[model samples]
Target: MQAQARGRKARRWIIFGTIAFGAVFLVVGLVLAGQSVSLLNDAERARGTVVGLEWRKDHSSSSRRNRSDDRPAAYPVVEFTPAEGTPTRFRSSTGANPPSYEVGERVEVLYHADSPEDAQINGFASLWLLPLVFGGLGLLTSGIATVVALVTRRRSRPRRSLRTTGP
Candidate 1:
């Protein structure tokens, strides 16, 4: 009985941990996804050119706590001229190791109708990366947790017995 109780407790803890993990990821994903949806709905499209690249040097020391020590990242600096406004220059928030964009390359951009400074490169990879990543992880974890709980429950259930009368 004690062993069974322990098993049940462990299984419960597992379920709880999995659920917590999934919920955190799901919430983050939903928030990001919601932001993307809002941007898609109200943002204006424009053609922008990669005018330059900004390099960011990592300042962290090479200690156990600092994993990114000396690695540097580069972000794209784009210039776009709105229909009724002067040409605006903005730097992308995302940075990549090898750099994602080249100077003079034209790309599609999405900017807020009222605030052109708030803009992002229009694409699945740039706009929806966090949403897809977190949502996928949340769904995967939740599915695994469900499967584990079901299997545990099945194993713990009392089996029915069949009896035959005297022949």
Candidate 2:
């Protein structure tokens, strides 16, 4: 009886822990989403060209390659003319394995009119990737917690016994 009670407590702790973890992720995702929206609202759009690619060694934990494979990711260097400033060149913070853009390719850029040096490529991956990834993780963990809670509840229910008498 004591062991059963301990198991139930452990399961409850697990459920609570998972829920807390998921909530943290959800909050982070929401904060990032809000920042992205604010940036877009304050930014001015301009036409830009991929001037070059800056290749850097892939040291991020998200990299999918084995330790032996050491391939560098390519981040685009863009040059654009802001509404009130001369042409400015800035490298994108996001990088891809196969290179997302080619040199001389035209693309949409978003930047503050006052600070053309701080700009970003106006695209789904550039702006929304982090929020989506974090939000997905939060939902996944929350779903797991729900499933565990349901299973624990079902298992805790008492079962009925059948008896037969023969003459």
lDDT of each: 0.85, 0.89
lDDT by residue for model 1 over 35-133, one digit each (tens)?
A: 999888878899999999999865655473466455677889999977667898888888787888899999888997678887788867678888999
Error of 2 at 129 (Å): 1.2
> RMSD per prediction, one decimal?
2.7, 4.0
Across residues 1-167, which tens digit of lDDT does each residue of candidate 2 receive? 99989988998998999988998898888888897898889889999999999999856675555666678989999999998769999999888889999999999999988788989999888899999889889988988898888988888889878878799
TM-score of each: 0.83, 0.82
TM-score of 2: 0.82
In terms of TM-score, the best-performing candidate is 1
Residue ranges of candidate 2 with Cα displaced over 4 Å:
60-70, 158-167
Q: What TM value does model 1 have? A: 0.83
Q: In model 1, which regions exceed 4 Å deviation?
A: 57-70
Model 2 poorest 10 in a row by lDDT: 58-67
Number of the top lDDT candidate: 2
Worst 10 residues of 1 by lDDT: 61-70
